[model samples]
Target: MSNKRGKGPMGFGGPMGGAVHGGAKAKDFKGSSKKLLNYLKPYRLSIIIVLIFAIGSAAFSIIGPKILGKATTKLFEGLVSKVSGTAGAGIDFEYIGRIIIILAVLYLISALFSFIQGYIMSGIAQKVSYNLRKEISIKINKLPLKYFDKLTHGEVLSRVTNDVDTVSNTLNQSLSQIFTSFTTLIGVLIMMLSISVSMTLVSVLILPLSAILISFVVKKSQRYFKEQQNFLGHVNGHVEEIYGGHNIMKAFNGEEKAVKEFNELNETLYNSAWKSQFLSGMMMPIMSFIGNIGYVLVSILGGYLAVKKTIEVGDIQSFIQYIRSFTQPISQAAQIANVLQSTAAATERVFEFLEEEEESDNLSTPVDINEIKGSVEFKNVHFGYNEDKIIINDFSSKIKPGQRIAIVGPTGAGKTTIVKLLMRFYELNSGEILLDNTNITSFKRSDLRKVFGMVLQDTWLFNGSIMDNIRYGRLDATDEEVLEAAKAAHVDHFIKTLPDGYNMELNEDASNVSQGQKQLLTIARAILADPKILILDEATSSVDTRTEVLIQKAMDNLMNGRTSFIIAHRLSTIKDADLILVMKDGDIIEQGNHKELLEKKGFYASLYNSQFENSEAS
Candidate 1:
């Protein structure tokens, strides 16, 4: 019952942040990236098409400045000739018009290519996200209950929502940016060199300074980004916990504590977020200043070259444009690096969940559930949530078919653990549980579980109509059958009294109904299941004494000719049980008929007497 397992992969605060400003580095960047890329293998041809489109877009855009430079040179030549009173003295508007048309076509093509690639990439990203969410949903069912014991609901939800979105966004936006940036960088550099090597050298000289400054800022900001992501997850988790238990917090006067905790987490997140954003904000200005210096140098050099007629005036214009284009990609590449880190972190968490050890079904040919009898036995079972600390030791018991058995004990006496072991929720460290003298492991877990119906202390109902919630016990059950089960559980009158009868919808937490109603609904579900073996763990504890008596009668009718195991703290409830199992310190201290145990004046008798005294006092 003491689940002391270590935190699962998603248990560190929660999932990492989704944005570039709050990107966290992966523990195994290369490994995680490799795994992530594997998901894209199915769309390899689409990705290739995206790459081609992206490159074409960048290439076409990069060629525009150089071509426009030709028009500038032509215009300058005609103006100079006109100033000199030459034969060709006027500007050639026709030539300039033709160049304008070419430039317009080029830019239009570039935009079209960009749009097409973006459209394709968006689809790919969404499909990948869909696949990931689907896998996570399926994995939730496949995971053992112990896995959930080590993780919070928020942590698991974060992976399915936030982490997967991060990967998807990165794939959609950043991926195409990467292709375009590199292509632009290369094409712009080549054009710059072709225009004027001397100016190109001067322009390229500023890059080292830009790189050094960008690197310094990135190095300083990386830790803050990581911290931002960490704190973001903590804030999210805290908010989820507080919101989910709003009523409990109010009842306990915990609003101040909750607010204080939120403020602390929010403060940390604000600090990290601003610091990372400020540092990242510095990159563009720094690059621009460095680029301005390059521009100044290029301009002065181009003027000298132009004075000497070494290079055309338009070439200088083109070279300056190329220098500006070149620095843009460098800035983009730097940002993309951080984005990649975030993507890797997100993908790593998703992959970790997907790769978690699923519950193994070792039975190749499982025993049929229909062949199983109601007889149950536990033989010398030794088990623990954590192997080093055993909770159930040398515990053994047997129940004949149709026997009404009650397991009574103080809290943590391993009473619940016995039922958990019987259902194979957690594998026993040693010993075997038998269903009609056959080892339980011989049956598939799904098939074995079909033989039992459980109505526990905690009732669970999803957001649905009362009819749907009840019919969850047997998915194929018709409305008539569901109504029959509800009546049998004594919940029919309650349902009919409501506004919509069984059609009334439960809210997200099913809070519209009272505690007793929820319990009745669960009982209704179990009755609809009509399982051969039944487990009632404090099943009627929520209802009032009058309702409890009514439910008891209904349960008695339902339990007739069925094997039933009842675990209860109210000893008076089980006075007529055919057998009472008294558990103490993970072992059965005494077990016999209720009257026989009371006559013995031992542990069971004392437990029953104490409960009886408490009832009398109340």
Candidate 2:
């Protein structure tokens, strides 16, 4: 259905609408609707059955007006006969009672069919929603990290929540409504025409005016509805960003700025919402005006036809009832078309997300994790986040099993990118990384990742008990094992100080614990994993100076025989490394033991001196 003819009686084009909200706009109604129909194909049998019941219900209800007219006609004839003093002057109470009973039975049947159709349609709608959401959840795991880097968390979440809700709600309420309205309209039209074509003409004449009014209101309101949806996404994004970064924002005195930004987005959403609602609300009143006019004309024409003996009194009454029934369905059908357009808009977003390219899992002969040694070699690697710019150009490194390596570099010197590449978190532009004489790409991603344990500068802890968080590193680990791992990480003492010990529940924001405590907990998690290789990216950066000494001792014990790579800003922490690699820009400028680099008086020597000099100055 086209937008012009598809608007709801409220002038709203879809399930919900507002003005000038930013985001994706509704696409071509016909194209989106066609795609949405594909999802319904699986439920075609149930949908057909629902439609049959809906039609049966509407047909039964349509028959009532005709039967009711008989009661009215019989009463009128009896009154006239009594006045004329004729035989059979009194009312035929038995016949009138029978007609009333038949009308009641027809209405009861109609109601029952309506209920059945609704019940079945509700099931179909819920199933479709469940399936769509499940596909989206699975799709999230397949998407590359770059996709997330480009889209905000709230934007992706909105597609799953708001957009899916819109589609589900429309299907549940509007789909069967459309079927019933269409059947009722057709049945009423036929009945009205059978009574008197002249009275039917009066009713038909008002349809053009209704069409014009509905078309105009829909065109004006649809744009606002699309805007409202977009603004809603923006509002959600703003709120998510602020909430996640609440601490940073407060530390930098950014609360006011965040509030201001939120208010701007909120205001835009409000404007679009109210305007769309106002315009849509106009549709019902306009439709009613036209309907009333049609009713007046139908009544006048029916009275004229009766006087001319062109139609019976009861038939005229039935025609009037049919007119009332006919107009209601006509309006409902028009509104349903608008609802369908809105549903298509929502369904398209879901399909678009599902259609995104997934990471390839084509390595059928993946190396087993148990077979991998701690040895790693990067052979003339080339990489970049984007194709046009090279960030890690001609990089090469080799580390043997049980070796300790430290990577030291200024910001933006590709220090982290090297670790990312080694883990195969990103695909290489050229060259390869190998572990235990086998290329990393020769193993499944899961198997390759299992061989390494990482403790990053930023500690992440979910809302769970301390024991639960530690066990996250290895799901099958026992409580005793978890406690042992915490002891090995030197975090057991602090954990024991808590009233609930390991059983304490963390709040949603996990703000109850200090930063140093969170860092220690993450270290405990890595200890539990007991991976073949360990990567520490400033793992103790958040700890106090006293705690740092203990953590360093714990990490040294943990890395006793494992190939370990440490990336640290504190030059003192890596002074005992087996080898230190100093990077500048995207290239390694100096690589050797700390003493060898200091004696060489090269880039590493200068960098090491600068840090201490800055600390002493401060």
Candidate 3:
């Protein structure tokens, strides 16, 4: 099944869509922010302690300069007094050195604590990301097949890789930076007030303008941020389509069309990316300009105050340095605000999947089929992929234990759909399908699928050893059992000649293996299961005529004691069936054995004769 086919054909307008009971989720950035904070609740104490250390670290870093300034001013004051003879003045250089050494010790303690806090916070962030990834992966497994039926492989992968990565980085980088910025701002403001409350007032006159600029930039950046994520989704969807259908494009001579379509999508992606980055990039410059204007105002104002002897020169100098520290952190904090918004958008998408409702099943236990009787019955079965497009209407059938049933149909006939219903992939809209007099709906889905083994036209294999691929049918099957199944499928001889024999690693999508070989492996897997109900869906379509003959013999042996349902276009292959059903337009129009259907001289007879003549001609 290709992932790009969203929701399935039943989605009507969309290709391969899934159940769309709910529309797109409506989530706000505020909600995402709250959820992220909740994830940190377990480490609140550590977070607070880290914050305290961060404040102390920045404060101590600022203290060295203040202490040096005070000591220098006192030394100069004593020199002036000594020269003017106003009083006997003495300054102790020793005491100044001791004070400087004490300040150094304080800064060292702060640095040590800062390092420890950084390591612990980062550890918490990484742990959170790891837990989230594991939780999402487990949730994905529990999701119903219908959910996967609608979503593309690349879109889901983006949720895992892109969304999770964004969230992880925000926790590790933005959250911590936010803490440091706020603390630095508060600490610097307090120091400024202590130095001169009046001067502090003058310095922050430009702050309102800075705040407004930051808010405007952030508000505008929000839309572009959202558009960027949406465009990224489109890009991922496009890439998945192109890669999966590269061969199809070449076959249809659509390479130029594909390139043009892809380029248009890429261009939209580029525009969105530029808009998002451009808006964020403006934050630094706008804030920088405002801070510089504030600095100039404070410098000129402080000089006036100093000349009037209202504040000391050293105090004005210290005040300006504090303002510098404060502005840098304030501007950085604004940028963190913008980054967090973008991260929240991604978080919202991720949690939307987490919150999605999956299909529900009430059956707790199923009849274990150690030996299935293979009696299948469709009792007044009514089914449809959608309400508007009914595939089977009042369909009924009964297959006696160990009987062989052949279903013949045109392209839109419900033959293949019958098999899907029999397996209970999609529940019938208003009827029951019974197996050996028991309703299949009463059985667990896993147990129901286990009763049958299938070989389909599309041959799929994993990137593992041949033994592992075959052993997928019955996980407990041993090496000898696998080899036996392969032998029965007429694939063992080829496997033995390959490099490393059955241990050879398959390549991407098993592309290195031949199409016939891939089909043989799936058939071997089905054989290893030794199921009660066997379905061969054009099983030998890819093989040459010689291999087809061999495969038919192998399939006959495999289906000897099982109830078999075969869907094939090749009419000659089903001549020995006990019951032959010819269907058209979702309804069975003709029936009976080969000889009886020929006598009816109806749709079945014409189809049989035409195919008979084609065989004769060949």
The C-alpha lDDT values of all candidates are 0.87, 0.82, 0.76
**Cα RMSD, each candidate:** 3.7, 4.7, 6.7
Candidate 2 matches the true fold with a TM-score of 0.91
lDDT of 3: 0.76
Tell me the tens digit of each residue's lDDT in model 1 across 357-394: 99899876888889666999989999989989998989
Worst 10 residues of 1 by lDDT: 7-16
RMSD of candidate 3 to the truth, in angstroms, is 6.7
Task: Spell out the clash pairs found in candidate 2.
Answer: 6-338, 10-280, 17-225, 18-224, 18-225, 18-272, 19-272, 21-227
Model 2 ranges with Cα > 4 A deviation = 1-35, 229-271
| Model 3, span 473-560: residue lDDT tens | 9999999999999999989998999998899999869988888889889999999999999998888879888888978888999999
Question: Could you tell me the lDDT of residue 98 within candidate 3?
Answer: 83
Model 2 per-residue lDDT tens digits across residues 1-618: 001111112223432232121223457667677777887899999999999999999999998988888888888888888999997678999999999889889999999999999999999989988998998999998887767877767568867886787778878887887788788888998888877787888889889888888788777876887677666656765666677677888899998888788788779979988988787778778877887897788778878877887876888778878877887766665556666665667778778888888877688677788866699888988888888988888888889999999999999999888898888788899988989878988888888888889999998899999999999999999999999999999999999999899998877756888888888889999999999999999887888998899899889999999999999999999988998888878788889999999999988888889998998998
Worst 10 residues of 3 by lDDT: 9-18
Best to worst by TM-score, what's the order?
Answer: 1, 2, 3
Model 3 spans with C-alpha error above 4 angstroms: 1-26, 36-107, 218-279, 359-365, 608-618
Pairs that collide, model 3 = 5-16, 6-16, 6-17, 7-16, 7-17, 7-18, 7-150, 8-16, 8-17, 18-150
Candidate 2 positional error at 364, Å: 2.6
